[model samples]
Target chain A: MRKIKMIVEYDGSNYHGFQSQKNAHTIQDTIENALYKLTGHKIPIISAGRTDRGVHALGQVIAFETEAKIPSDKFYLALNSVLPEDIRILNSKEVETDFHPRFQAIKKQYSYYIYTKDSGKTFLRKFAWCNSEPLNIDDMIKACKQFEGRHNFLSFCSSGSSVKTFERTIEVCQLQQKNAYLKFDIKANGFLYNMARIIVGTVVDVGRGKIKVNDINDIIKARDRNAAGSTAPPQGLYLMYVEY
Target chain B: MRKIKMIVEYDGSNYHGFQSQKNAHTIQDTIENALYKLTGHKIPIISAGRTDRGVHALGQVIAFETEAKIPSDKFYLALNSVLPEDIRILNSKEVETDFHPRFQAIKKQYSYYIYTKDSGKTFLRKFAWCNSEPLNIDDMIKACKQFEGRHNFLSFCSSGSSVKTFERTIEVCQLQQKNAYLKFDIKANGFLYNMARIIVGTVVDVGRGKIKVNDINDIIKARDRNAAGSTAPPQGLYLMYVEY
Candidate 1:
């Protein structure tokens, strides 16, 4: 069996999540069903990360074993022909038999977009979070800087995640303003469940002057979910890249 | 009674269209219902343009008469509170008694976004037209320039529109590209039904070398619907702004 690695893109609005569950539609189930149609085998695929419901991914990575005779370049086109318009295979390549997309991933990048206008634009309503309140970009940036290092990010992550360790390295964290949108670009070695959304929520509170910038360290030290800001909505989070 | 003009935004994926039709969910009908809930009377709103099904808008302008005593600034917040998350009133102000959103509009700007990547990102799937092909952007720019001046766009218009004259002045037409997305920003005194989409489709053909740059002028001169390219999908077209 050859290991096939693929770059996948999906609109997660109508999906239960990335994981396959009984009686629930999910991105994984959709692609796996399409693969079953193509290869005539139900091959379970592994993803770099599991996205929650209503969360989206632009370049999500996945891998699966297949005995089909098709070439690597033909995998993307063949799978895409059977996939729905909302889900697509961006690229495909062959990988080592021992390679795992999730375990071997060195870093992952995610972007959270916020339409900061007094009202949201029509097309972006389903994708970006709309907040009419004035957000202090400077304060948000200052708070974001505090998160740019290795720390036990227990407070920033939601409870009930299967992760055993809260320690993770955040290599880069940035807040950028473009036109009427504020985008958060974050890169980390690993992330816990709903970590990025909780980070954004905490920073948003800082921008709204509800929390002090230095409070981020204390929250991280507290290792408590309730110590952080409320979890930001799922529509704003996007998995941008997974580096192997 | 005071005439109030509103700049509205809505996701049209779930609506029939802009105009109110029997037994169908239209953007106009939804907003009117919200208005009726706020005031105890029915008020008909006139829109600057009527967008087709699955089309979205950012700066669509509508005007209605109301005898309510709410402050003008409060109109934005009050209406937003009652409106669904998919539709929002971005701005509201009192206009001249003679001001008509449809009749007195000086110019309108519309943009068509095309996702020309091998595959589109998940979050943008609903808002952008997904076309999988590498096209020459320079050729599109050259052909798009021919549409910048006053011209009779009869050929680009859809059939069944009852406008007497097809002559319209185009103040600006620009084709801009970023990464995998290409946007055509076109401003004109008025657009024929499906004119923007047809124009975008025709330009995309030019970009793909399916049509010559000079063929745009010839097509316009033909003044026949068959002379234009296929009507692009409605989701890609956005009513950007209107000046009254």
Candidate 2:
């Protein structure tokens, strides 16, 4: 058997999520079905990030083991020819038999986009969160800095996650504004369920003056989900990169 | 009665075209329906450009006469509340009663986006034309200059147009490349049916080495549709601005 690693990109607008489920449309099921048509075998793949519904991805990493005879480097072209237009294989290569996508990952980066125009842009409605109300960028920037460090992120995690620990190390947290759009980027060792979105929500509240900037530290220390702001919607979140 | 001139924007992926048809969904029909809901009477609207199906617009100018008591500038906000997510009124103001969107227009600008990456971008699939083949940008740029000045564009115009004159002066024709994307912008006094798309198709053909760059002038002089290249698809075309 050969181990194959691939970088995938998907819109995720019409998908339930990255993970496969019964009686639902998903990115995993669509790709796996395309793989079945290509290799004539049921190939279950593993991904580094199992993104939630409506969350897009630019460089999602996945690995799978197969007994097919096709060369690994050519897998992207072959699979893209069969896969739907919303999901595409960007790069594919053979990897060591023991190589795993999730376990050996060192860091992951995510970005959330916000359209701050008074009138929303029609072309960007599916990809960006439209917040017409004015946001204090300086306050939002100050709040982002508070998130960069090791902390117990229990306040930012949603319910129903099976993880044992709520602690994670955040390496980078920053916000950049271009024209009428604001992009929030964060890098971390790992993320709990809805951690990024919750953090963004809290930061947005700070920008809106609903919460103070210096209170982010207290929110993290509170270690309670209710202490954080509401979870931002999934459409604005994008899994940007996975580093191993 | 007040004459209202509005700048509109729309994602035309789901509509038949800008013009209203008997049984098909269109941008015009949607807006008219929205206007009827806001006002108590049936009001017809005139647009600067009747974009084809799947052709987007960022600054489409439209005018209408209404007896509604709402302020002209506030009409955008009120109409947007009732309009669908894909269509938006960007700006609205009272205009002279004789202001016609089509006949009084002095110039119009349009843009076409092309994605040249070997692998298509999932997010951009709906808005850009994806051509994996390598293109010669310099050759295409040279061909763009030939499209400037006044010339008989009958060779580039598609059939079924009712215009009496085929001569139109182009003020600007340029192509800008950013990473894997190319944007072609053109400004003209007016356009024939499918003229901009055909011009792009011909320039693309020049980039692909299918046609010589110098042959453009002769093709325009020929004044026959058979002498021109194929019509580029409508999804990549956007009515950028309409000037009066």
Candidate 3:
């Protein structure tokens, strides 16, 4: 048996999410199905994180144990041949048997894209959040500084998450404006359920004047989900990469 | 009655082309239905050009005569409310009553995008053509100069097209590479059925060494559909705009 790690890219708009369900189609299920067809393995492949429905990924990481004789480099080509067009294996390699995608991951990067009413990127609707008005970029950028460093991000996490703790270190939080789009890029040691999305929502609210920028400190200190702004829609959130 | 002209954008993946047909969900029918709901007019819209199935458009022009009380600018918002998410009216204005979208159009700009195997833009599979090997962009750009200026484009048009004349003036033809994407932008006075796609296919063939760059002039002069390379797929083609 050999352990393998793969970087995957997927347009998650058509998927129900990352985790497999009984009837719905999920990214995890689609990849597992393809893997079964290729290697006849039935075990669940471990992922760095489980994404919500409609959330896309650029460099999502996954690991699995297999005994197939295929070479490491050929694995991506083989998997991509059998996988759907929306999901592709970007790269693959053999890893140590003890490697765990989640536990061994040091940091993760995510990006959120927003299209305001003034922009006309209609084809990117599935990959971006479309709002009625353009968010104030200046205010959003200022509020991003509040998210830097370690914090108990329970206020940014969704309810029903049974994690042991909400403490996470945000290494970077940036807002970039390119033409008609506002992109939010964030890097963190680890994220709670929907933490990145909630942070985006809070920043957007700050830009919209619905939430004060200084109030972000209190929201993190409160450690209450209701203390933060609403969780942004899943479509705009992207799992950019995982650093191991 | 007012002649309303609108610049529209759409993701053509789900559409059965730009023309209306029985038992098909076309962009034309969808827009007509939305217009009918917004206004009581059941008249069909006239478009600058009819796009085949799965061909996208960023600034497709359409015109229709309406007696609705809604202002010209407000029509876009009202129609978009009833239209599908993939289709959007970018702009609307009042046009001359006798102006015909096709007959009065002077030029049109179209682009074809190719995602090379090296790029991980797998998310754009539905909107671009993906190829494994890298295409020779330098040779392709050189061949583009041969396409500039007026010529009989019969060889570059698909069969079964019965146009009055095959002469069309090519204003510009350029192939540009950005990262892993190859974009072919062309401006022409007019195009025959699948003309732009056939031209792109020939250019791609030239890049692959299947056809010589110097052979393009002879192919255009042949005035035979068989003289050109195969027609490229529709998904990669985008109608950028129509100049009136």
Candidate 4:
């Protein structure tokens, strides 16, 4: 069997997530079904990240083994032809047998978008979280700085995550505004379960004056899930990239 | 009775169109229902434009007569509190009794987006039309210039429009590239049915080298619907703004 690597893009609105679940629609299941139809082979597809329901992805990488007769370049077109309009195979190429999408991923970048306009039209509601309340950017920026270095993010993670290690290094944490939107771009070697969402929730709390900027450090030191902010909604989060 | 002008935003995915259709979901129906819940009166809403199914709107303007006791400035919050998540009232204020959303409108702007990237992520699928081939912007710009000013746009309108006059003034027509996305923003005094979408479809043909730039004038002169390009999908078209 030959291993093939692909870049994927999808609308997560109708999907349960990236992984397979019984009776639920998933990005993996749709792509795998499409691949099976194209090559008449049942292949196991692995992704770099398993995004939650309603969370979108761009540059998401996936790898699968196949014995199809088509060349590597043709796989992109072939798979895209069979995929749904909401899902797309961006690029496809032959990869070394040992190459695994998740195992080989060295870093991941995620972006969270919030529309701070007093009102947004219906068109942008799904892609962004509309916050009519004016947020304090200075206070939020100060709170975000506390998450820049290595730390145990257990307090920021949601419960039911099976990760054994909660300690991870954040390479970069940057926030900026564009037009009426505020974007949070965070890069790290690894992230714990719901870490980015919880981070945003905490930052929003700071913006709302519910928590002080320095409260971030105190929350992290507590190592308790309840000590951090609530989990922000999934609509605003996007998996921007994965480096392998 | 007070005439209130509202700047509305809505996702058209679930609606038949902006108008109230028989036994179909519509933006008008949704907003009217919400307004009825807020004020126990059946208020008729007049809008600046009527968008098709799967279309989206940002700054659509509407006006309605209501006897509700809510403050004019608080209309945005009051209506939004009762509206569904897909629809939002961005701004509201008391308008003169003579102010009518459709008749008093000075201009309207619409934008069509195309994804010309070879591959794209999942997040932008609903917001743009994905084309595998790269577009020729130079050719498209030349074609767009031919469409400016007042002329008979009969060839560019949708199939079922019954408007008597086909003359409309195109105030602004421009195209821009944002990352891997190509967007066309056009402003006009009025549109003849699906004029913006048809213009986008024809220009896209020029960008794809399927049609010559000079053919736009011929299509306009021909005054036959078949002479123009295909009607683009509704998903990529947005009612950007409606001005009074």
Best by lDDT: 2
- Second chain TM-score, each model: 0.97, 0.98, 0.97, 0.96
Q: How do these models rank on DockQ, best leading?
A: 3, 4, 2, 1
User: Which pairs clash (backbone N, Cα, C closer than 3 Å) in model 4?
Assistant: A9-B121, A9-B122, A10-B122, A122-B9, A122-B10
TM-score of 4: 0.89
lDDT of 4 by residue, B129-242 (tens): 777576788999888888889998999988788899999999888888888888899999999899998999999899888889988899999999999887888878889897
Which whole-number lDDT from 0 to 100 does residue B127 have in model 2?
Answer: 89
Alpha carbon lDDT of residue B122, candidate 3? 66
Model 1 over residues B1-244: C-alpha lDDT tens digits? 8988888988888899999999999999999999988887798899999999999888999988899998876787788888887888887999888888888889999988888765555556668898868788998999889998888899998888999999999998889988778988999999998999999989888988888998999999999999888888898888989986
The TM-scores of all predictions, comma-separated, are: 0.90, 0.94, 0.94, 0.89
Per-residue error (Å), model 4, residue B225: 2.8
Task: Summarize candidate 3's per-residue lDDT along B106-195 as a digit string, tens digits.
Answer: 999999998886445667777888776767889999988899999999998877787889999999999999877889999999999999
Q: Could you give candidate 1's per-residue lDDT for residues A1-244 as a string of tens digits?
A: 9999999988887899899999999999999999999999999999999999989899899999999988987899999999998888888999999999999999999999999776445556657887768878999999999999999998988878887899999999999999998999999999999999999999999999999998888998999998999899998888999998
Q: What is the DockQ score of candidate 1, to 2 decimals?
A: 0.57
DockQ metric for all predictions? 0.57, 0.61, 0.67, 0.63
- On residues B184-227, what C-alpha lDDT tens digit does candidate 2 reach at each position? 99999999999999999999999999989989999999999999
Cα lDDT tens digits, model 4, A1-244, are 8889998888788899899999999999999999899988888999999999988887789998888888998898999899998888878999999998887889999999898875553555667777768789988877888899999999988888988999988988878888998899899988888899999988998999998988888999999998988788888888888997
lDDT of 1 at B221: 94
Between candidates 1 and 4, which one is better according to lDDT?
1
Pick by lDDT: 1 or 3, better one: 3
DockQ for the candidate 4 complex? Answer: 0.63
User: Lowest-scoring 10 consecutive residues by lDDT in candidate 2 chain B?
Assistant: B117-126
**In model 3, what are the clashing residue pairs, if there are any?**
none
